[model samples]
Target: MRRIIILLLLLVIALGSAGAVWAHGVKITYTVTFSPTIAIEAAYDTGEPMANAQVIVYAPDDPKTPWLTGECDDDGRFSFSPDPSKPGTWEIQVRQAGHGEWLKIPLDEEMMQSGQGVVTEGGDEGFSTAQIVLMSACVIWGFVGTALFFQSRRPPAQEPGEAA
Candidate 1:
């Protein structure tokens, strides 16, 4: 019985840890630096180097300005030279192929000059509604199965006529 209790507690902890990981959103970190030239570094949510991710920079004054563009390398990094003559607030946008959401980052002159940009995917750290419902159902079914399994494994009751 004690072993069963310990096992149950361990199982609960393991499941909770797994759920936490699933609930956490993805993160991307990069830097926007100016050396009279523009430089950037980007990484994917998985932390694995991402190559070919699209990155676009737009000057705040004129969104239509021929924006600078670059693609992340195998190490998930990219750098480009922005028109130094045009210095103003800039918007950085990144998108991975097949990913529906575009990460929009705003950088002021100070930030651009200092070179810092950090963006995280999925703002919230929690399961979606559908996922929550499915997980609840799974837990309930697991408990019901455990109970039935124990019941089935129990020894049969002894008859009154049987010797002690």
Candidate 2:
């Protein structure tokens, strides 16, 4: 019975690790256009082939209705045109089988003002290089602190003949 329990635990651990790798391995890219037309393009992170993944474009202000929907190609690419006549910010929601989560990409005003892309209100826009750098630094510091915490928890090795 103990052997069976150990085997089951090992199998669970292996499967969990595999699932984590698969989830992090796949990357979704979203390119949204707000001007000339409201459209979106998507591709995989590794540039791997993709097919049949659903791409939904919605009004960020109103998630109840999606303006456009389409399936990705075998090349891991998908496109959607949401009523060109309607203007403003938009949000993209992407989903693929085995991905297990929805990927959300925002099209903000700065991207639209660039004269080639669409923009959505309240979406990320005009992020300066300094802001990016600061955010990156914060993330790095957070990871460093977490690592230090675990390292400190490890028990110190006792010297020979040391008291128990």
Candidate with best lDDT:
1
Per-residue lDDT of candidate 2, residues 15-41 (tens digit)? 445422322234454555445343333
Question: Lowest summed lDDT over 10 consecutive residues: which window, candidate 1?
Answer: 117-126
Give the per-residue Cα lDDT of candidate 1 at 75. 67
How well is each residue in 41-147 modelled by candidate 1, as lDDT tens digits? 45443344456777777866777653777677776566666555556655566557644123344545554454444431222123554686578769867885887
Candidate lDDT values, in order: 0.55, 0.52
Badly placed stretches (over 4 Å) of model 2 are 1-41, 98-156, 159-164
Highest TM-score scorer: 1
Cα error, candidate 2, residue 54 (Å):
1.0
For candidate 1, the TM-score is 0.46
TM-score of each: 0.46, 0.43
